[model samples]
Target: MSVLVFAEAINNKYKKSSLEVVNYGAKLASSQGSNVIVLTNASADAAAELGKYGAQKVLNFESDSLHDNKMLSQIISDVANSHNADTVILSDNSKGKSLAGRIAIKLDAAAVSSATTLPNLEDGFVVQKSLFSGKAIGHYQMKASKKVITVAGNSIGLEEMGQPVAAEAFDASAYNATVEMVETKRVEGTVPLPEAELVVSAGRGMKGPENWGIIEDLAKTLGATTACSRPVADTGWRPHHEHVGQTGIAIKPNLYIAIGISGAIQHLAGVNHSKTIVVINKDPEAPFFKAADYGIVADLFDVVPRLTEALQKFKAS
Candidate 1:
């Protein structure tokens, strides 16, 4: 009944999504009186931090093939098999999606993605998930002896329940690639949008790239990450990395403030999971208002500056 959690580390650090899956796995294991074990390539010190979230042990692996889905899956499958773990958990993000199927195939397990709730053993191992861009909820039952689940980001909160412990080295060489030197380019920002707790986003209604200062001001004042709709990115008004939509990066921030963005279904598919939505648009008929917890029907040019000023004053006081 042991649970194994695969929380991949990137750039020598653990992403918020990684800690989230570890937290989820810890909760699942605690319920069954089983210890949680995390598999990652993070440094021993960083890997040991998982113990604070109830992970009793960490299995550390290192390879230049971290991006090789097949090789990473093989390593994970081998580790899980050796541990005799009945359940495996990972994030439902791109990397996790790439590896989950292959790991499941190797282990002869049933794999499920976008799990919004923990597996319920009381009801035949059912887990809840959202459907139709969060328009509906569905519960699935995993019937296989082994289960592989990809947990939705921010579906659960983090908790620190135990002391830290050192990570143990793991030896695995199912597959390794030989490659030459390559140049890498990264989009740099103050806060990584995917893991941000607060976000400020705009769209085509912003009119031009010149007007983005207000959005940036608001984001800076609130210490939130900045984002934009697809069309805005397509027009070169904002970097493609800042775009949030079906065709762009998905996010599950705690508070998502969309300014001048018309909510298309494609855009909604990416951020519908956010805890709270605030839409600011001049058109009262805008579709974004329907999904917003708070809607402001006013011109963003007039509203954005005022909002930022108010927040600055609030913070100063």
Candidate 2:
């Protein structure tokens, strides 16, 4: 009856999606009248922070094989068996998706991904998920002794409900890892687009890379990450990491501001999960206007500078 949450840490802290999944697991555990446990690759001391997100116990596995999905799945499966946990929760990210299937196979459990809502325990173990790239919702009833669920990003809310609990050490050395450790490259300073609350993005309409000063200024003013559409990234106007579209990175920011972008369907797919969308374009018939919560029909050259100025002034005041 216990629920185990995989708390993936990024840049020495828990990612937003992982925290949200932990909260969701906590709620699920509460519904089942069981305790929620969190497993992490972070230091045992750092796992204590997860307790505020409603984790009753945190299991910290210190290993260099954090990037090895096979080893991680083996660790998770072993922990689930040890605790007799019926449900395992993870964020629907790359690592989670890869590990979930393996864990399910190893534990002889049912695995569900892209879950948007919590399971309905009153009836059968029915969970709601987004299908066809978030165009539709599908409800699935998993009839298995154990279950693995990977929750969608930004689909659930986070609430802190408990005091910080000490993290216990977990030994994962017994499991043989198929992959070896390699050099790690860590990107620092900038806010990760996936975890950002606010994002300022642009597209080809901005003209060229030299004109990116306004976009950067606007992002700095709003404390937001900077993103670009597929075309913009393709043309090298911005780095590929800044790209947001069907073929690029998917984001779910609280506030998304787009300038000089025509909002193609592919681009919209990546940012459609944003809570508030603001678009500024010269074309009145721009497709982005249709999806924007706020639209301004004006030249971005004129509109962006003024907007950035206003934001800076407001912050100063």
Candidate 3:
């Protein structure tokens, strides 16, 4: 049995999260002495990079309607059926999660989402997943004919296994799903936190909504997205979209900078996956300092502008 990985690409380049999934899939395939196939909804050129992640073959499907979840599910179902793939891997991003659920339903496979590690391939394919906002780990094994899993973002490393492989195009019968694509209202300057490499966040320490310009300025300079603690949204200092906590969005950016924030457990629940954390607060006893990779105990009013200026200089250099 072979493994098939769904490689998500945008603007002709594979996304970073998809790379992680491919790495995980490669390992799984290798353990079973089977080949790993990478599939993309884009053109052959788009799937060519999959070779670096250990994909033996790349399956390319070209269709505009493939962006629709219902239609895409049919295409994926067809691929899985043709290959009789034992395992199907996907990136645990929003779209991938949705597609995994739909594919599992279509194929009648046992599915697991937000998988943080490779499954134990021995007795049965038991996968480890994070639960309760990462407070707990759960292990599950698929008892169905097929298994579908979505790898969590930033949980695995991408390694170049071989040279670029030739990609083959695949054609599938399109499904007539009722969901029609309309105009897309893309939000300007709003980066998806899950996909961000760097994130600059603020907390109730900023005191008021007017003072948020400093945080926004820093984020703009660093090409990072803005996030807030729950209180910031609760107190009307920022919009709900900016909230990043247990009650809001969870992020795993490469660098997360928290300003004027006391590290609340709820806030930490969301950002605990950050590779590196920087905390700036006036209170020397702030709990966030315990978890911070770097900490500066100073008033945000004095620290933020100076930090922004330093970042500007760093960027210019």
Candidate 4:
């Protein structure tokens, strides 16, 4: 049996979450004494890069129309059957989550989504996952002969070996899709928040959107993506895509800096998974301070510009 991973790509490159999933699948495959195979909708050239992360073979599906879950599930099931895949891994992103259930049904596999840690295959297919917004952990065992796992985004570390492997093209000419291509809109220039290692997020405590220059300056200096609290997005102070909360995007960046945010539970639920949380606020008793690795109780207007200058000097050196 082999371990198969669905690696998603954007703009001709694999997304960070996809790479993390590949690394995780590689580790699991090693433990199972099986080969790792990565299936991606990227070009053959781009798919070849998966070798560095321990993929033995890369299956390149060149069609963008294959993004549909129903079509992708069927294709994935066919590939898994060919490889005799005992384990199928997917990134817990929007697309992966949607496809996991469908693929599980097609393969008659027990599926687990948002798994935080790799499965313990020696004792059965038991996987550890997060629950209740990261407040609790659950261990689940899959009884099916095959298993489907969607790994939590940013939960797995990427391991690259500085090598490349050739990719084989997958023939999908017989698959008929009901969906048509539509216009796509994307935010350009800035790093994607989902994949960013560093994130600089702000809230209503910043006073007004007109005074957002310091936030932009600091983020630019540190090569970070910018984010906002749910209220900030609702009020149009920031775009809705930048919102992070219980109802917004959940992130687990290496470094998360919060400026002027009060640390509401909804907001904390989204960002509490960050490796290091640095909170800056005028209020000394803000709830965010409890969760912060480092906290500065001062005016962001005074503290942010100085921090930006310091980072700029460091980068220039």
Choose the strongest candidate by TM-score. 4
- Superior candidate under lDDT, 1 versus 3: 1
Predictions ranked by TM-score, top down?
Answer: 4, 2, 1, 3
TM-score of each: 0.93, 0.95, 0.90, 0.96
Q: Can you write out model 3's per-residue Cα lDDT over 1-317, one digit (the tens) per residue? A: 88889887765767788788888888999988888888886777767878887888889876544457877777777887888787899888777888999999888899999988888878687988978876789998888978899999888777788767878988664457668777555466667777888999998888888888998899999999988999888888788888897889998899999998899989998888799999999999999998899999999999999999999999999
**Candidate 4 pairs with clashing backbones:** none
Every model's Cα RMSD, please? Answer: 2.0, 1.6, 2.2, 1.5
Residue pairs of candidate 2 with colliding backbone atoms:
none
How high is the CA lDDT of each candidate model?
A: 0.86, 0.88, 0.85, 0.88
> In order, how many clashes per candidate?
0, 0, 0, 0
Which of 3 and 4 is the better model by TM-score? 4
Can you write out model 4's per-residue Cα lDDT over 160-205, one digit (the tens) per residue?
9437899999988788776665866777899778778899999998
Model 4 backbone overlap count:
0
Which residue pairs come into collision in candidate 1? none
Ranking the candidates on lDDT from highest down gives: 4, 2, 1, 3
- Model 3: ten consecutive residues of lowest lDDT: 61-70
Q: What digit string (tens of lDDT, one per residue) describes model 2 on residues 5-41?
A: 9989864577778889889999999988998989988
Q: What TM-score does prediction 2 earn? A: 0.95
Off by over 4 Å in 3: 64-67, 188-190, 312-317
